[model samples]
Target: MTASYPHTRLRRTRATAWSRALHRETTLTPADLIWPLFVTEGVQVEQPVAALPGVSRWSVDLIVDRAREAVELGIPVLALFPNTQPDRRSEDGAEARNPDNLMCRAIRAVRDALGDRIGLLTDVALDPYTSHGQDGLIDDAGYVLNDETVEALVGQSLNQAAAGADIIAPSDMMDGRIGAIRAALENTGHSNVQIMSYAAKYASAFYGPFRDAVGSRGLLKGDKKTYQMDPGNTEEALREVAMDLAEGADSVMVKPGLPYLDIVRRVKETFAVPVFAYQVSGEYAMIEHAVAAGAADRDAMVLETLLAFKRAGCSGVLTYHAAHAARLLHG
Candidate 1:
């Protein structure tokens, strides 16, 4: 007799845990995470960011201890951001070139304490150092100038490189900055330093908590619509990725990860490069809020969200929950 309606059982494979596991397409592990940490000036202090629940701005001393914990958890890298003090903020952002600046100091301390046991990535941008909270230098007309900002970025990149930054991450989104930075690194003999370009950074509402963490929320006079990519565009992202790759980016990143998994997938498939994503501040806060409201299981939500990145073809993720998630994975 011919097969009937009940002949095919599609759910048979899912009937057993081993079968389900074998068919799983995505997985999360400790190696697929890069912890993003916030730094402030002081000793032994951990200031909690109000908007980003469970996240803190640590001092260099406390960060060293945190680095040790991350190493123990098998997380391969850590990205650093600084909460630059008001007095240090300037129109020219000259403090960014200071070798003893807070970010550089933290980089040096972590490298000295851990060496090659963990990779240290540093943020190279003027937003934290500028009084106006813009990523680049502003002209008299209040417009951000591309070439001027590239000059400052070169100085900032070399400064971080001198402090032992293993990866120089330029999140500014300024045109031609990647090529300029690559040339500067080669000339400065930091040829081994990797460049993880924020190749498709979007100007989304998802950055509120991150601004608060860096103390730039109230300082930004206007939106960053000119430089950052519009959230409505997709083809522009591929063009940006192509430019960065042509300029010699070691890897590329997609920001605000989950909402743009399509972009992540497209970039990875088109370029066949090491693609990464940033589970940005607002995304982190939203998940935490849902968990707090009893709408979601915290541990399950974290693991599920992280696994989604892998399924979307992200080589790794820069996430606020890296440490806690790493602990869960290790357990």
Candidate 2:
């Protein structure tokens, strides 16, 4: 239809790819991607996670190869998760502090191979090392003990840093652990090690695949509702972010990305820090299965979901799709 002098046309910019690119508000690239890799004990293994297609539990030697690939791809960071052997899982999660544990070994292997070309982010939680599959040690009542857990986390953080981890990420969601870990890091002369707190982590149902990836699903004795935030609240997430920031978090994360992009936006808006999001295991699995079911184009869906995080004000995202997205972006 013909328009009058005062009429406006919104589709002009959307008419062409070049026009759309020039008018775009958010851009996704490999630099904004942080690949999350799972490490299991071995030399040349790539254990497929059946629940999480295209994801695997790589061994130490192969992890070095992953680090080299990340360096080549311009992906600035790689978050490492460990699948502890059955015999190594303990009640106190004491293996978490071992200098030569699976996680520590993976961190060292990567750091030694790639140097500082890519940041090695180690998850500072005990779920992978615990017999009960809880992030913290539980008492007779099966309730997670806060103070004790903080101590264990502090030890875990120090151990990771000692193993040359560039960032110590506390994903446990326990109270007072950030400050304690920071203080411990400084006291141990590892003051430059960054702390990326999983500040607004919600106890959401989207973590099943993650638990499976880390081999913790079956061992989980109870849920983490007492520690991780409830999914029904928003104000509480801000409070959690604020507390973590004030406690000396170098940066903060909002987990289970798509479901909590609101929290990511609010965190970036309010704190004005380098807020990050985790395009977690379940999210990855859903997209993979959707592509398998022919619901959406795989490449398009991956980039769209990642760009949503950038539009919501995230500095970067920890995603399993980092490699695929990087290759697409490069192409």
Candidate 3:
């Protein structure tokens, strides 16, 4: 049977790749990718993260190579996370404020090698440096103290800024830390350093692989529900974003990208500011596992998931698949 169609047929434009490209409302590019790299302590060492397949922790020397690779790939920014040695981990997480710590060394090394070619976004949380594997200072009861944590974070931010970090990313989810960090940065001669707050970070189960990558999974005593947002709440996510923005955050991030795209869209719409999402370690692992099990195509899944962030109004995304996706987009 033949059916009559309307004069404007959407299928006509969708019939060709060129037509689709010309009509594409959203675009993904290497410029929209922020590659996340883990830095370890050694020379020319690359330790593979078992939980996060295809991801590895590179030493300071090798991190320079990775930075060069990112520059060659046209990736504008790199987010650095450190895997502090167990001996360096302490109850006070004081290593986070060390001028010569692993994170500071990597920042200085990359800045010295690459100069201003790329932006360095440094994580300001203390979980990697803490013996208790918490993002902040804890009392005897093990509760993460908000004010004390903010003070430590201010110091951490200043340390990174002194080490030439271009962006200070406070991922601790602590209240009022953004304003404190921003003020500290301004007073300490780092007025240009940006703050990308993990504004609506949730205490989600998807962070297990990340914890392992940072070497904090085994050390974590309890959940971060007391600080990070509850996954079930949406309005609260907006409030978080609002507070961070008001606190002078240059940008805001929604973590575990795919699962919280709704939150990303909401934040972007409500705030009308730059919104970024983290295609976190577990999200990357899920794709890798699916491909290994022959359940999906790796390349297709990576691009599709990344493009979803663009469609959801993300200014850019911090993705483990950044390099691979950039290569695919180049092709």
TM-score of 1: 0.97
TM per candidate comes to 0.97, 0.98, 0.99
lDDT of 3 by residue, 222-250 (tens): 88999998999999999999999999999
Q: Runs in model 2 with CA error above 4 Å?
A: none
Candidate 1 positional error at 15, Å: 1.8
Error of 3 at 127 (Å): 0.3
Query: What is residue 19's positional error in candidate 3, in angstroms?
Result: 0.8
Write the number of the candidate with greater lDDT, choosing between 2 and 3: 3
Taking every candidate in turn, the Cα RMSD to the unseen true structure, in Å, is: 1.6, 0.9, 0.8
**Residue-level lDDT tens digits of model 2 in 1-331:** 6656746778988999999999998999899999999999877899999999999999999999998888888899999999999899999999999999999999888888878888999999999999999999899998999999999999999989999999999999999999999999999999999999999999999999999999999999979999999999999999999998999999999998999999998899999999999999989999999999989799999999999999999999999999999999999
What TM-score does prediction 3 earn? 0.99
Candidate 1 runs further than 4 Å off: 1-8
Model 3 residue 251 CA deviation (Å) reads 0.4
**Lowest summed-lDDT stretch of 10 residues in model 1?**
1-10
* CA lDDT of every candidate: 0.94, 0.93, 0.95
Compared with the true structure, what per-residue lDDT tens digits does model 1 show for residues 23-112? 877878999999999999999999999999999999999888889989999999999999999999999899999999999999989999
The segments of candidate 3 whose C-alpha lies over 4 angstroms from its true place after superposition are 1-5
Q: After best superposition, candidate 2 residue 213: deviation in angstroms?
A: 1.2
